[model samples]
Target: SSFPAVLTCKAAVAWGPGQPLVIEEVEVSPPQPMEIRVKVVSTSLCRSDLSAWETQAIFPRIFGHEASGVVESVGPGVTEFSEGDHVLTLFTGECKTCRHCTSGKSNMCQVLGLERKGVMHSDQKTRFSIKGKPIYHYCAVSSFSEYTVVHSGCAVKVSLAVPLEKICLLSCGVAAGLGAAWNVADISEGSTVVIYGLGTVGLSVAQGAKVRGASKIIGVDINPEKSEIAKTFGITHFVNPKECSESIQQVINRITDGGADYAFECIGDTGMITTALQSCCQGWGLTVTLGVPKVNPELTAHYGILLSGRTLRGSLFGGWKPKSDLPSLVDMYTKKEIQIDEYITHNISFEDINQAFTLMKEGKCLRCVIHL
Candidate 1:
């Protein structure tokens, strides 16, 4: 089925940096070849979305990457999916022909990362516009709007059995966190795990560790209030950096008897990145960084940290190939192996979407599901 050549819909437009998204009536063009048009059913807010909103470099672009929706139309030559099929949007693409995708070593497919120029890869054009001015796509999904056109590779077909509102969390943050523990970190049973930051990602990490049979799960956060929620996800220990007279790393070392077997940094601050590495056990500890840093994306960790065999790794989309691994995550959620429904702290309407951001800024939400 094909949508009209043009359709008008409401979208939250990011006019400039450090500004509230203006909900505007925007025009969405029909999908070009190799693209598909989706009517967003539900989308969730992530810190990366917040980062893009605050950064001046990505202004004037639609900023949403995690969402689930139904297919409204399919462009020519699209065979993997059709109109009315339920789908989840993927910020990370998994074009099977790509070297990375074929090698099975990484999920950083070339096709997904190829659109850094802020336009559709097929025709190098913007599919959205307001008053004839083009709106650049954000992370290839731009799900902040009621409708979005994206590469067919960016849409993952999933079971209709799961509600779009509940499963949308798998579109990004949930998958990234679980994959970090399961795939990237390859967390082992009986391991000592420490996670910095008690947001959705960190809490998901705790769940992953529990699933893998980790004996000790420690959660560190500046906010002591997050301890209770973190505990719901299997966090057995909580460390408030403010309560310790010494450094948090030293505190963690004393608590873990030396250091944690694995440490994850989900706060997205470069300074925390260093501390996350140092909190790991010497000679065999592995640290994974799942946060998206807003500025100065460089780390200044001590050379001794690496010299002692503490490996530092960066996990994007939790190192899972979206098309292959994402569906299984949904299955996990369906089977009750992971928590998704519990993560939703708020259900918001499209007009009140900005309140989700406010809730995020105030550390009052785990994931805000925007009902489109």
Candidate 2:
């Protein structure tokens, strides 16, 4: 029997850092072993994509990770997913055989972990190319193109009943926030929670806290406009650091009467990590950092912060093993146990992808879904 031929499709390619993406016809190769080719129906713009586009030295790359689609073809030795199966692309995969996957204590899969070099984990080669020139992939799920090939472990099969466009948010931002609240922090009922930065991720954290029965969910952002919209996600208060006379931490401490039970730094600024720690109560206070810092990756918190029994930890993809955990999140969305549609502030065409980046850079939109 003959196999499918190489596909030439439209993909937004970034030739260099901070450059606008160029929509061009690129050749997508057939999936190798342990991989699957997907027809991306919907992709969302994420801050990490923007940061990578603006900063990462990897050029001639395709960048879109938070996405939903249908499996177009499966590679050799793959039986978990079939052609036409609806799926969500995962940046971090769960190779169930790894120690972390077996331990049930971590979502970081060693074999299919985060790919920083824009290539497949199994073969170290990209499936996207133009005229024999390769185009690097971002987070291994380059959904900016009409079609993308990803490792089978990096894609999670979802129900066909869910809308591909809306459920795409759960691929990253929404799931990350909810997981931080539920899995990492295990926020308790009636506890005070302070979240720094009210982006989609932060707001999702707020929503998770609310669902966990937290009494006060304070959202801190520079934009005062986010306050009204954030209230719908269960934020009880809003704090604008620029408007406060004292430090933001001081304001939070004063309002909560002794700092909050939990504080999350959602902004990708490492500087805010310390503020988040200080904003938490000394005893049993937990600070979870969810942001991918664009600069100054190193964090500096006073020794006393730890001495007082406060704990600081980091969360990646909300500590979710994509293949094993994302399906439950999809179920939660279907049951209305979570808010996926609320985060979609704009719907855009594939041609208008640059506009989505502008909306994110200007902080004008929570999430911009690109219809491919």
Top-lDDT structure, candidate number: 2
What RMSD does each model have against the real structure? 1.2, 0.8
lDDT value for candidate 1?
0.89
Query: Which RMSD does model 1 reach against the true structure?
Result: 1.2
Error of 1 at 350 (Å): 0.3
lDDT of 1 at 260: 95
Tens-digit per-residue lDDT, 1-372, candidate 2: 245568999999999998999999999999888899999999999999999999999989999999999999988888999989999999999889999999989999999889999998988899999999999999999999999999999998888899999999999999999999999999999999999999999999999999999989999999988999999999999999999999998999998999999999999999999999999998899999999998889989789999999999998998888889898998988898888999999999999999999999999999999999
TM-score list, all predictions: 0.98, 0.99
- The count of residue-pair clashes in candidate 1 stands at 0
Q: Give residue 292's error in model 2 in angstroms.
A: 0.4
Measured by TM-score, the strongest candidate is: 2
Off by more than 4 A, model 1: 1-3
